[model samples]
Target: MQLGDISVNFVELVREACHKLNVDPMPVLNEYGVTPETLASPKARISISRFMRIGQALISTANQPALGLFMGQALRISHMGLSGYAAMTSPNLERAIRLWIHYESLSSVNKRGSSRFYLTEESGVAQFYSISPYNEFNYFVVDCLLSGWSALAHWITGQERLLKEVEIEFEAPPYAQHYQQAFNCPVKFGRSRNALIFRKEALLLPSIYANPATHSEIVSICNRELTTLVGATSLTERVKQIITPMLQGREVGLTETAKQLGLSEWTLQRRLKKEGVQFQQVLDETRKQIAETYLKATDLTIGEIAYLLGFSSPAAFHRAFKRWFGVNPKPFKDQHASGRTDENTATGENT
Candidate 1:
């Protein structure tokens, strides 16, 4: 399955964490082709694989394994963008959480499926879908999400330690103790699901930022944005479809792509800009997604895959693959071949 992309807002959070740690994040950000201008764009996004590489880079630079926890603590409601605004204006925490979940695609896209919320009369369980075959590169993703939700709940209610308990899908790492400190509750590892358990009554608490009229207005705005997002996604998908069959040891430039789409190069650029993406960004993302699928799901040799994806050479493909996933393609393919799913084997560098 093709992985999805995360909003550039997440890159900002990583930058914030870098500042808190007194580590300069520019070198790493630049290495990933992210800039202040890119982050300023509300529609900018990074592929999930690329973001994982960034997280791994930051963790190494800061020498901090628990960076995701720090990031989670730094999360503010406004960081979530429109989905956050909708939640902030909702009349109660329960409705706020539901609204946020419903509109989450506005901020990030996870093709595995969005997080799920199961509400009972006495309790509510907020479950994060597993992005499993866990490794150091990805465990922090779960950490940031589960703890970020806890932090958001506390922020909305003006209360601390709102979770009854936390459950993680993987075994406890060496930094497992930090999970408890982060959540301020019993955290069970090796559980069937990654979830936050909460008191249903607590969910009924009125949001500190709640307003009936403002919520109505924000929900209306979110609806419009969601519609726009869907339309923009269709455009991106069309571009990807055209780019796919063209990559065969040859570069697919924007002009060529525009010709294929029956539009002038300038017109194509304008449309993509309206969708919050550049032509080059779509091309690169398309290559990364296809490269990953080829490495994971086929017996194609590295040179063949590289040729198929239009890389100049196998060595060049090696460099790009490392840049995309923070690992050499050979090891990644080998890991999958051996069915090695242990989180303990994931050291962030090679995983």
Candidate 2:
């Protein structure tokens, strides 16, 4: 339960990338204090700084500045471990993207910055953008993310998609040609944003593993993992996780949550106060998050949704929904069904 900052799974990817170029990765791993065991663990992680150091090492060892593109191309959903399986089993590309956004932190953590996806109906495209602190390996991160998206989409949908365009925040490198060729699209460097623009229709493709029954089961598993991830990292997340499932059939309160966490009510209250949160605040936030998901992803009736969230009545749920979102639940669900989404809002970093 280390809840690693970067998934150790990336070690295999880095190794594969180096092997393809006939470069040995042992030196880099040794230099960075990474080990074969670290890479072998499905749950261990390395800090963000160390991850970047390793990425730099991989690039230098391979003698290729565009190593990220190559590594991403070699990645498959199966390589993502549990996170990958969840995405592969999601109903569609869009749903899979949302699920990944929601559960990403269960596998890795991002320190530099997070990523967001914005849909522009007028442009007929969706833009996946990253907000990261400037660093030497920024391009590598961008390349891997964009190319990874392409690769994952292809794997899930059995369709090849060429990005509409790729934007980089830095100047073009000497190997910019490789990027252009790898993405099979125009790669623009020195742009204000690091993003991959794709046609909206591409997100509508059906996943080969799409099954309503399986999707629900996988999501439940993801929720449990997310709970574990937060429990290891933050008290707030642990409480939220506890509140999520319990909201379905029983009253969730500080007393019950504290008991579940093996702490006294007073101790739990004090801990949350130390974290600058109150029990009520966490409960409300958790409800808002789950409410949005149920409205958008499921066909449950408003009354049923309300009951599922442990609200006594649909009217009670409506009142709370309005307070949280400035709109009623029905309208919110309608907007989501119509293809409108919260643009700047996402559950986790793009990775």
Candidate 3:
């Protein structure tokens, strides 16, 4: 399955790791268009492509190829957003792990039919989906996910060396020795699956933080979000998904989009029409949503945002912004920023 966008929450893990190494992450983050404001939004997502690029750069800068393993050690429940909270309050380790797997999309998205991670409850094994043909670009993804889950399991259940063993799909790399430090358990490579094998009895370990009332409420919220996420498989939604990643530095037209969707141009048009939306409309709407995000959640200049959004020129972007919001970009951004500040202040006072 093709990779999709992941939550900015995961990016924070990288940033925290950089801090531990005394490496400034901003240079790499800015090079990839990740801004402070973007990280501030719990709901914001970074494309998987950009996330990988950031990881590679950070690993190089720190001269630590096993950066993902160390980064996983830094994982905390707070880093997971709502899903973490739900898992923390679960009745036991098994339920907590299941909640994490079930609500995985709250933190990251895989392609429509793909599962990013799974748990074999009966065996107490948790598996991360393989994105093989592993190289410097992607090996860290597997390392971070499996190790991160193990770290969280240990933290919640108050168990040290919680995993019985780790099974990696790929053969050991040059840094194989470091796996011992990351997992503190038997680490086997060239296995059929990438998994963290838990001691069966450990699956019943009670969470130190489990709270029945809180768990119930958070699960309800997660269920609603899951419903909204999975229900968005409409053709228009699919078109937007195809359009988002393609907007990095170039305009994506209907022909390219239909090609990506594996549908002929004419057929794509007919289907979108059947959904009561036009191709250009969907494209513009997608651009508008992304533009709003860049404007509100990044310090990027108008020209920079324009280039990222695939506008022909800054003037073109300004005109489009005016058309979308009925105002020019600068004042509109200021208005929203001020509103956010006020909202934050009010929230603080209430708390």
lDDT of 2 by residue, 200-316 (tens): 787787899887887788788888888876656688877775666567645688888899889999999999999999999988887787687657644457886787677988999
In order of listing, the candidates' clash counts read 0, 0, 0
> What is residue 107's positional error in candidate 1, in angstroms?
1.0
lDDT of 2 at 105: 69
Candidate 1 TM-score, C-alpha based: 0.69
> TM-scores for all candidates?
0.69, 0.63, 0.67
Report the Cα lDDT for candidate 1.
0.80
Give the candidate number with the greatest lDDT.
1
Query: Candidate 1: lDDT of 141?
Result: 87
- Candidate 3: residue pairs that collide: none
In model 3, where do residues sit more than 4 Å from their true spots? Answer: 112-122, 235-351
Error of 2 at 112 (Å): 3.1
